[model samples]
Target: MRFLRRHVDAVYDALTVRRSRFVRVEELVIRAAGVVPGLVPTPQEIAAEDGSIQRDKSGLEIDQGLFLSAVLGSERCGRHLCHAMLLPRPEAQALLAQFERDGRVKLDGASVHRAGKAAVVTQDNPRFLNAEDQTSLDGAEICVDLALLDPTTEIAVMRGAVVEHPKYKGRRVFGAGINLTHLYHGRIPFVWYLQRDLGYVNKIYRGLAFADDAPPDEFGGNTIEKPWIAAVEAFAIGGHCQVLLVMDYVLAERSAFLTLPARKEGIIPGAANMRMPRFTGDRIARQAVQYERRLDCDSPEGRLICDEIVETGEMDAAIERVVKGLTNSGVVSAAGNRRAFRIAQEPLDMFRAYFAVYAREQAYCHFSPALIANLERYWNAQSRKP
Candidate 1:
């Protein structure tokens, strides 16, 4: 551990002293991997000791986790990491320009449209049931940036695009969570988890952070933000369900459902652990995350997360009405109220500390053999193709 810390600290110190330009968690991991070989341990290292069932923390995988936790937990390093995450994506400007010119920017897996007073961002990964993966990450984040930054829009709406899956053909399915087939095929990188949470997902919750400003700590930090509404059509599973926790309001179809099967997936379900209990209390949250309890949208328990349940085909009209209602009162105080509520519930420091632990633990889980076994047993991952 000491040896690993020395290398990580040295690299961290160099970046600090050099005042390096902003880089996302994924970039930082790649940079560190270049300097420290085991920072991104090989599959052999993960297979050795059989995923450390004895709780032995001496593997290179543990070192990877420790190294990341050390960097993410640091006051200087972690703050910059968070700031980099909150900054607009590289293609954000172009995309925003296109949206302003054409009223929409449609990418491969996602798109954003201007609808009345709201910017509606749609997730459109049809092949995998609107699942999130590398192909969709940047596009989704950029579209989110456009949504909040658009001067013409007072609010933002998140919804799923019609998917092509045989079971739910031409139906709007919110998301299937992570791309397990990609994960099993070694296409999903470890940093993808952090990127999703710290980048677009966090942007949806806390808004965009400026480069010259102080860390957006919810107390006095300045940010460009707007209230977000989530329209859940079919179901929100795992990461997508976690997103509902951050939204200002959630509108779900009567037949829709929600789940956080972290135990079955062998991974932390983003920030659901920290934010879900606030809505459903700790016991039900535990049941959902640990025991795979599914919450039906019409049920009393599900209502805690979903604000209104509409008929299956009434989602479009419901979204339009809700957006009108939220903006009709004049949303001048929307961002302020969001910050006020956030301060009492979850300040920036609390979220940062939680993610510090999450970064390390999730890295370990990502490489654990149990994750592979769970995917094969539960998801039939081996039979599926990316």
Candidate 2:
């Protein structure tokens, strides 16, 4: 671990200092690959294999994966990477200025509208039922950053915009998870999973790390943060369900359901394995993540994770009432209380340890033959158009 940490630190510092910006996991991996050949597949090989690089063919890749996992597992390096990712994104300052002036910022795939004391982030991939893809990710993260940084906003609300899909036209869908079509079509990269979990999703959970020199609240440093609320209309599936786990309050329409079908997808469901057990016990979490257990929003099991379930048309009113209630008394201590609860439940060290295992294992899963087979078998992925 110490050896791996030294290498990680050297490469991390070189990339960030030379580039004058924080390094993303993919960029770090690319730099590390120059030092260690065969650590990752070449573009030509990836194109030949359509992103599913067979793991058993290379001992170098396996050993390198384990080495990277150890580096992430180490407390010092893991915390360093986590803190770096939480720093405000490079585009954030410009986006925040626009948001402040117009009270909104609309991007290609998502948008943020300042509504009263809440910043509402609407996922807008309507044709795909608001599924997240490479196109939507950056926009979503920028929106989230503006929401948390806005001084006038006391809380954040996340929901999906109305859709263009035939079956669900004119109706809002919470999200369909990762764009499986893109995954099957080789558009979703391996590091994308890591970037999502460690970047914006973690920001939603832990808030923004404002200073490069200081740590997050869990590490005894200050952060600019606000409570987040999730509104689920149709359903929250796969990665979308993972998002609900980190939300402070979840409001779902009575007909909505939640699911984490990682088994069918043949990938880790982000941090769902580590966090869902807190909401649903070990047995249920296992059943959901491994066996595709669906929980209806109004059901007893679903109510454990969902704070409130409202009738279809009642959602707008419910959101208004909840936002007002959360801020009516002033959210002076919201950030502190949230940090206190997180430190007690999922301190940064625990998350680091879990990701150590996830980092290596999910890499294998992403490039595995099984992933392709599972997508075709369960999702009919081969027939879907990207």
Candidate 3:
């Protein structure tokens, strides 16, 4: 075992120096034996230890230990010397075989070519589709091919598009793009839940609260105004338009259709519907335009906030369909979209009142750390007063 250990160390060292070389198992053993005196164990001895060597297997049966020792030394140098020492030749071969099977082993050019050919044969099957269909399918197929060549290619493409597109260049466009990108990438799943599931219930709560607590003078006040809204909206609309254009460029380059405008009305349509249920309905299409609040998914109102949720689920789908029908019939948008939106007094009032409450809630939440410290000080002062 000591002889084998020293030989393994020598083989590891050799592997680090000539990592690019394709060394045979016998060659590695010969080199390792030369480095460590009295370490030249016979083939029979190796077979006895590993139980994998056949009587007829002579003249360079692959020494998995040598290969592994080399690989470890090449990849991590001396850091894995202890691990290499523990793993015997047969054990190492078994591990190498497993790595190869799992596609975890790095391939040289010839190996890569062989694998690529096999993948091409498997994936590029013949189809009886028409020319138009074939053309449409080609883009995704090409994407797959590129992905095989380089896994990070898609991310690179998206990053490049975001940086180069005019809409993504400006502050407004960048900010909106960031928000949309975060949502699309599932970075803010909570927002979707809130808007889709509990929106309507919260809207009712807010409206009732507003009517009961707020004065009539608060009705038409510019309480919603904020300096950041205009900039953020502009950026969002511009970024959305740009992204649409990029997608078109890649997917439908020759087509000249326009994307729907990003709603810059200081609210996400779906989220606003949480405050104004009558306007959005259960489908929540208009809520896309009113993205003001973080969506929560745990509540019942949150179920209809997203496109997939609204389209497929039982209650959500049914509500969405009805809303779509009404919109198509011009019942919802008859008085011009803006004027129609303002027609529902009760829901709108509720939405505004809820917005105010939400803002206050956020403010208090933000100040919680300071508030706690202040409370402690006040308690101490009260003790002295008594």
lDDT agreement with native, every candidate: 0.84, 0.83, 0.26
**Model 1 ranges with Cα > 4 A deviation:** 3-10, 16-20, 34-64, 218-220
lDDT value for model 1: 0.84
Give the per-residue Cα lDDT of candidate 1 at 164.
91
Q: Write model 2 residue lDDT over 5-29, tens digit each, in one string.
A: 5576565455456334555665566
What tens digits encode model 1's per-residue C-alpha lDDT throughout 256-307? 9999999999999999999999999999999999999999989999999999
Against the correct fold, how does model 2 do in TM-score? 0.91
Per-candidate RMSD, Å: 4.0, 3.0, 29.5
Count steric clashes of candidate 1. 0
Backbone clashes under 3 angstroms, per model? 0, 0, 34
Q: How does model 1 score by TM-score? A: 0.91
Candidate rank order under lDDT: 1, 2, 3
